[model samples]
Target chain A: MNYPNKKKSFQKEVNKANLGMTLESDIDATNRYYLDSGIAVIHKKPTPIQVVNVSYPARNKAKITEAYYKTPSTTDYNGVFKGKYIDFDAKETNSTTSFPLKNIHPHQISHLTSVEKQNGIAFFIIHFKPYNEYYILPIHLLMPLWENQYKEKGRKSIPYAYFKDNLHQIHFSYQPRLDYLKVIQTVFNF
Target chain B: MNYPNKKKSFQKEVNKANLGMTLESDIDATNRYYLDSGIAVIHKKPTPIQVVNVSYPARNKAKITEAYYKTPSTTDYNGVFKGKYIDFDAKETNSTTSFPLKNIHPHQISHLTSVEKQNGIAFFIIHFKPYNEYYILPIHLLMPLWENQYKEKGRKSIPYAYFKDNLHQIHFSYQPRLDYLKVIQTVFNF
Candidate 1:
């Protein structure tokens, strides 16, 4: 199994507040577990990068010297589970009251909507950092709130109370770390 | 849509032989056409990269100073098609007589296998550069030959004759340069 170098990148900087086990890491571990256990074939897409320059320091060793992160057009994670396509993104917010809508790119929402239209399960896995809580909100549930935000009286963010009321909270586990698939099974029933 | 900068990278060096219109670029245009026409929502994944260092030259601008390309675990392209998961890789070979088996990575084969297990439509879009011909070979058709490569008496590569006989050649069009999905619909009968 030829893989890339083990060196970490600035991508992990966002999780510095979590000590070590951030929601992203937990989800990564869970996805790995899922892959190993034959439960599902999920994976986080590699971070999109726009390379400006590269140097060939040695033969077969191309090093990118200048690059910039690109906004991904699709969700961070996607895969097939029991003949169903699963697509989602994970976000963590420090606010205890609400999750700011700006965290999600408009492209992601449109991509998820397209996925849902094609009969795939699309969703967001949100982590309320202050409360140490995780919630899987399907795109179907999120659409109305998302549409409402553009209206005159709509809120720009989704309140934590709304998540607590409408979504099933995912709890931590040993093997998979975050048993999101379990929550998904109950929510999606497939 | 705020996209990344318009800087070309070493990634394009591989297609220098084509002068300009490589299979990749054609597929990119085709995918864009599919997106605009509201056809199947498929996309080629960004090149996987492993960043080692990043420097912030300005307040909000991050410049990646050191990075390396990673071997992709899955195929280059995947998305929802006709409410089904679609997965595939596009490869261009200069050879006219045969398509080298080594052109495919083991991880890609494994990933496609898993996709097929989950009932996703997994395939390979091969462009024989010398002949200006394209062929979409399903994962199932490729698997037996892949296994045979390990056997003592088996051939190392698949001859062009095999592809011509077994698969339908994808012709070029103006809107979607490579009409692969049409070939797929005809082949898979979906």
Candidate 2:
């Protein structure tokens, strides 16, 4: 665990070689590292799909012919870490100054709210593509902004400065690309 | 929460109306009840599928043309319950005298083992169809039986008497068809 702090300096050099990968892939790599090392058990839930038609091509082989993506009813990723239920969604924004609120579905907000009520750790891994910066925002901090946007007709997006000032930044690394759990260890003090 | 035990007497009458429903649908209904009543936040993960081709017939309406079901890498159900991470899979067997071990996948067993190591509640909801019986088997209890099958070349199935003697039976009710959480509260002492 002490190695988390020591891995910081090599982040930039390692991430430069992985510039072609998407945020989703980086997070997947990070989860794989966590799982393989026995540090945690995290996984990205497969995208939900609605199958309308299926054709049996041969014995014991069925192929789906018609289907559509379904909006997920829960967060993208969830698992157990340090004896706590961990839940979160990963999002990337093209805008340099703000992250659009629409990027987070309402169902996820409701689901995370329920998670928080049960004392599970709920959060977001946000990536600012233009700046190549990553931050972890706990559901508690996001709840106020989420409410204000709907109740008070506040800004539809969260300014980059808000995240910079209020949230914990996640450093990119060689093995676990995003290293959000390192931030979790510090933020949650686990 | 205190109402769990009180609802036991109404089981048979309510379940008779849902005689045609499968075990999966009953679990889904039970989870919905838990969620709506603010008791728990459990969910069954969507079936994983590998999509090969998609065509956009119109803007924002992509239709999948080819896909195949993928084997799941983890348990089917997981979420936060009473601040504890709960993970499990539901299974059914038509055999009258024994529950086949092959009904549970190797990946699911491995995933549940990891969940248990993290202090998460891990178990299975098993239904013996001919008897219309349901039992909750904790991962801790199942682990030895799982290992014995491979190491000692033991019996491939668990006898009906074993479940009736060792596991907690789940009563079927109107609101939550399979009241497995009630058994959890008693078994895990949450």
Number of the top-ranking candidate, with lDDT as the measure: 2
Residue B122 error for model 2, in Å? 0.7
Task: Report clash pairs, candidate 1.
Answer: none
lDDT of 2 by residue, B105-156 (tens): 9999999988888888999988999988999999999988888888766878
Cα displacement (Å) at residue A175, model 2:
1.6
Docking class of 2: medium
Give stretches of model 2 more than 4 Å off: A1-21, A151-153, B1-21, B151-153
CAPRI tier for the interface of model 1: medium
Quick one: best TM-score, which candidate?
1
Q: Please write out the lDDT profile of model 1 over residues A1-190, one tens digit for every residue.
A: 8653233434455446463357778889998888888788888889899999978776567889999998889998988887778899998888899999888889999999888887888999998988888999999998888888999989989999999888999997788789898899999986
lDDT of 1: 0.86
